[model samples]
Target: VHIIICFYSIVLLYPQKNMPQQSEAIVIYTGWERHALVGSDIRLSCSFFSWRWTSDDVTFSWSYRADGARDSIYVFHYTGGAPYVANKGPFRDRLEFVGNPGRRDGSILLKNLDYGDNGTFTCDAKNPPDIVGHASSVRLLVFEKVPIQAGVITGAIIGAVLGLLVLVVVIYYLMRFLVARRVFNLSVRSVSLCLGLRSKLQLILYGLAVTRCFFLI
Candidate 1:
C-alpha cells in the first residue's frame, strides 16, 4: 500500500517532467532594401537560424505590401520540398523559389519587375519547435534606371583620384628624366668644346716653338 501511495505521489508531483521542452525561436534575416531597374530581375534574399535541427517540415512564406497599401498579401509559400505561388497576384508568374529549406534559406527571385512592383517584402520561416519569432522585411524600389549606390560612387571617385595621381607621378618622373638627359648632353658638349680648345692651343704653342728654333739657327 505504501509503495502504491509513493508512486502516485511522485507521478502527481512531476507529471510534466518527461515532456519535450520547446526549442529556441527562429531568427530570420533579410537585406534592408534593394534597387532594380524596371523590366529587370532581382533576388529578395532571406535566411533563418534555428536551434532545432532542420527537417522537411521547415516551411517558408513570402508576403508583399505595395507602396501605400494598407494590408499585405501572401505571394509565395514553400513546404515539403514544393512551392505554391499565387496565381493571381502582382507576382503571379514572376516569383521563383531560389532557396533551399535544408540550408535555411528562403529567398526568392523576382523577374521582369515593374514600377508597380515597388513595395515591401516580408519573409517568414518556421522550423518545427522553433517557430516563434518575428519575420524579416525588405523594401524594393523599381526605377527606370537603378540609382548609383553610394559605395559605387565613392569607389569611382577614389579610382579617378588614384588614376590622376598615377598620371601625375608618371609625368613628373618623365620630366625629371628628360631634364637629366638634357643636363648630361650639355655637360658632354662643354667637355668636347674644352678638349677642342686645348688641342688648338697646344698646336699653336708647338708652331711658335718651331719658329723660335728657326730664328735661333
Candidate 2:
C-alpha cells in the first residue's frame, strides 16, 4: 500500500490587525436638517473616521439651544456602552443612548418630540488625544398635525364653485328677462297703432251715417 498526504488550506476571514486610516477629525454621519413629527423619535449621530482607532474611554455628550445667547440644555451623556446619562433636563425621560461606543459610534435618540424641541443640537465626541475635534452640530425641526386645514381648504373650493354657478344662473335669467321685455314692448306698440286706426275709421263712418239719416228724414 502507498502512503497518501493531503494539504490543508486556511482562509482568513478577519485580519488580526485591521486598523483603519486616521481621519482629520470625527464626522457626524446624520444629516443636518433633521425633521421629526411630534410625539416621534429622532436619532442624532456623531463619529470619527475609524472606530478601530477610537478610544474606549471616549465621552459623548449632546446639548441643545433655541437661542444663541441662552445657556445650552443638556440632552444626554455617555462614556461607554450601556453606561450613559439621560439628563434631568427637558429630555430626561425621553432620551435614549443607542450608539455603540465600542465601534466609536456616538449617536443618541430623542423620543416624543415636542414644540420646544425645535432648536440647534450639538454633539460632542471626545476621545483621548483627540478631544478637541470631535464636535458636530445639527438642527431639529418638529411638526404637529393639523386636522382642520384640509376641511378649510375643501370648504373654500366648494364655496367658490357654488358662487360661480349662482352667478351663471343669475346672468342667464337677467338676459332672458331683458329679451322678453323687448319683444313685449314691440308687440304693444303695434297693437296701439292698429287700435288708433280703427277708432278713426269708426268715427268717420258714424258721421257719414248721421248725415245720411238727416237727409233721409
Candidate 3:
C-alpha cells in the first residue's frame, strides 16, 4: 500500500517598492510680506516637490525659528503598516497634511492664522539622507480696524482738499472769461461809436453786456 500527501503553499504580496523616498518641494509659507496687514483665517501652506522617492521608511518634519530656538514643530512617520503623527507643540490641531505619502506631494496646510504664528519655516523629509526644504518665512499679519472717528477725519480732509482744488479751477476760469468779455465789450463799444447807431440799438447792446456781466458775477 502506497500513501501520497499533498500540501499547498500560500504567498502574500504587497507593493514591492517600500522605502523612504526623498523629494524636494517648496511652498510659499509666509504668503505675506513683512509688516503687511492680513485678516484672520488666512491659510499657510508649504510644499515639497521635485525629489526622488525611494523605498525606505521615511519621516517628515516641520520646524520653525521662534525666539531663537530650533524646535521640532511637527513630525510624521511612515512605518510599514500605517502613517504616524507625532505631536510636537502648538500645532496639534492647526496643522494639516494636504498630500498623500505615495504621491510624493508632501504639502501641509495651516489654518486660523494668528499674529503669533509669524516666522521662518524649515521643512524636510527624514530619509537615510535628509531631504530638506525651507520657506523664507510664514507670517500671520493682523489688520487693525480703523476707528470710526479717524475714518471720518480722513474723509473730511480728503473732501476739503478736493473742494479747494475745484474752487481754484472755477476762479481761474471765471477770471479768464471776465478778461475775454471785457475785451469784447470794448470792441463792441468802439464799433457802436464808429457806426453811430440809434439809441435803441445802443440800449440793446448795453442790455446784452449787462446780462453777460450779471451771469458771470
Candidate 4:
C-alpha cells in the first residue's frame, strides 16, 4: 500500500521527458547579392551565429538546384574531412567544400560556374541531437556574356562620328552658299532636317558606346 502510494505520488509530481527542449540554431552570412559572372567561381557561405547545442552526431549536408528539378540538384554529406558525394551528377568535380564541416563554417565554392549553374542553393542541417534547424537558401544569378562581333561595335561608332562630321561640313557649305545668295531665303526645313539627322546618328553611336561599356563590365 505504501509503495503504491509513493509510485502514484511520483507519477503525479513529474512527467516523463520524451525529449528535451530544442536548442536555437541559426545561419548568418553576407556578400551574396551581386550577380556572379558566368565561368566564374561562386562561394555560398554559411556561418552559424550561435550554436549552443553540443552534438557531433548531427549530419551536415548541402543541397543545391539550378533548374528547379523535382529532386535536389546536388547533395553533399560531410562525415569527416572527406565529403561524400551523395547526389552529385553534373557538379561532380566543380563543387568543392571550402572549409571543414566539423566546424561552424559551411561555405562551399563552385568553380567555373556555367550557364546551367544559375539557381538557388540550400544549406541543410539535419539530425541534431537536441534541436533540428531549418535549412538556409541563397539565390544565385548568373550573367550571360554578350556576344560582340569583331570590330562591328567600334566600326559603327566611328562611322557614325565621321558621317556626322561630313554632314556638318556640308551644312556649313550650304549655309555659306545661301548667305552669298542674299536674295535666297534659307530653307528652315533643310536646317531642321540636318540637325534631326545628326541627333539620330549621335544617339545610335551612344547606344553602341553603351553596349561597349556593358561588354567591359
Candidate 5:
C-alpha cells in the first residue's frame, strides 16, 4: 500500500511538459533598405533564422506605404499553400514570387519599378505558435535612372585628376632627367640651324606686315 501511494505521489509531482512552453523562438531577418533606379527591378531580401523549421501553417504577407502616405497598400499575400497578389494596386502583375516559404525564404521580386513605389515594405510571416518574431519591414527608395550615380561621377572625376597628375609627373621627370644628365648638348651646326630658322621666321613676318601696310595705302 505504501509503494502504491508513493508511485501516485511521484506521478502527481512530475507532470507532462506543455508543448507551447517548449516551443522555439522565431526570428525574422529582413535586409536593410535598398536604393534602386526607376524602371529597374529589385529583389526583396527576407529570411527567417531559427533552430526549428516552420513548415506547417505558413503564411506570408507584404505591404507597402509611400513616403508621404498615411495608409499602407496591401502588396502581396501567400497562405494555405497558395499565393495572392494585389489586383487593384500598382503592384498588380509586378510582384514575382521568388522565395520558398517552406525553406525559410520569404523574398519577392519587384519588377518595372516606379518612382511612386518608393516606400517602406513590411514582410509578415506566421507559423502557428512561432509567429511573434516572424515579421520585419524595410525601406525602398526608387528614383529616375536618368540621373548619374554619385559613385560613378565621383570615380570619373578622381580618375581624370589621377591621369593628369601622372602625365605631369612623367613630363617633369623627363625634363629633370634631361637637365641632370646634360642630354641636350647642341653642336655648333645645330645652333646655326636654329638661328637660321628663327631669322627666316622673323623675315617672313616682316614681309607680311609690309604687304598689309602697302595694301592699306
Candidate 6:
C-alpha cells in the first residue's frame, strides 16, 4: 500500500512527463490603426505564428465592424486551399484574399473603398493544435485625401535644417579663408617695405662715409 501510494504521488508530481504539451498560436498585425483614401485600395496585413507544423489545414478568417456597429460580419474565409469571400454584404465584391496559407499570411485587399468602409478589421488564424489565441485587429480610417505622415514632415524639416547648417558652416569657412589670405598678403607687403627702407638707409650711410674718407685723404 505504501509503495502504491508513493507511485501515485510520483505520478501526480510528474504529470507533465506523461502528457504532451501544446502551444497556442500568435497573431500579428500592423498596429491598431491604418489610414486609407476613399475610392482607393488598401491591403490589411496580417500574419501568424504557430508552434505546430504548417499545413493546408491552416485556416484564416477576416471580419469587419463599422465605426459604431456593435457586431462584426465576416469578410473573408480560407480553408483547404480555397477562399470564401463575402457574397452578400458591403464587401461582397471588394474583398480579395491575397495571402498564402502555406506561408502563414492572412492578408486581404479591399478595393474601391468608401467612407462607410472606415471601421475595424480583425484577422484570426488557426493551425490545428495552435488554434487558441487572440485575434489581431486594425482600425481603418477613410479620408477624402490622406494627409502626409508626421514622420515624413519631420524628416523633411530635419533635412532642411541640416542643409542650412551645412551652408552656414561652408560660408563661415570661406570667409575665414579669405580674411586669412588678406592678412597674409598684408604681412608680406609690410616685410617688403621694411627691407626696402633698410636698404635705402644703408646706401645713404655708405655715401656719407665715402665723402668723409675723400675729405680726410
Clashes of each: 0, 0, 11, 0, 0, 0
TM-score winner between candidates 2 and 4:
2
Show where candidate 5 strays beyond 4 Å.
1-18, 21-27, 35-41, 127-129, 157-172, 183-217
lDDT of 4 by residue, 128-196 (tens): 543445577777777776455457899999999999999999999999987877544356667888999
Candidate no. 1 TM-score: 0.83
Off by over 4 Å in 1: 1-18
lDDT by residue (1-217, candidate 1, tens digit) is 9999999998888858486767678899999999999999999999998877897889999999999999999999998889899998889999999988889998899999999999999999999878899999999999998899999999999999999999999999999999999999999999999999999999999999999999999
Candidate 4's C-alpha runs over 4 A off are: 1-34, 50-54, 68-70, 145-217
TM-score of 4: 0.49
Global local distance difference test of model 5: 0.83
lDDT of 5 by residue, 25-95 (tens): 67777876787888999999778766665767787889988899999988898888888898978889889
Top of the candidates by lDDT: 1
State residue 98's C-alpha deviation in candidate 5, in Å. 1.6
lDDT comparison, 2 vs 3, better candidate: 2
Tens digit per residue, CA lDDT, model 3, 1-217: 1222222221123333554444454332323333323344433443344345443555455565554466635444444535545576655566666655554444555556555666655555443344454543454334454234566899999999999999999999999999999999999999988777677788999999999999999
lDDT of 3: 0.55
Question: For model 2, where is the 10-residue window of minimal lDDT?
Answer: 1-10
lDDT of 4: 0.68
Which is the better candidate, 2 or 5, if ranked by lDDT? 5
What's the CA RMSD of model 3 in angstroms?
A: 14.7
Which segments of model 6 are wrong by more than 4 Å? 1-23, 214-217
Error (Å) of candidate 4 at residue 24 is 4.4
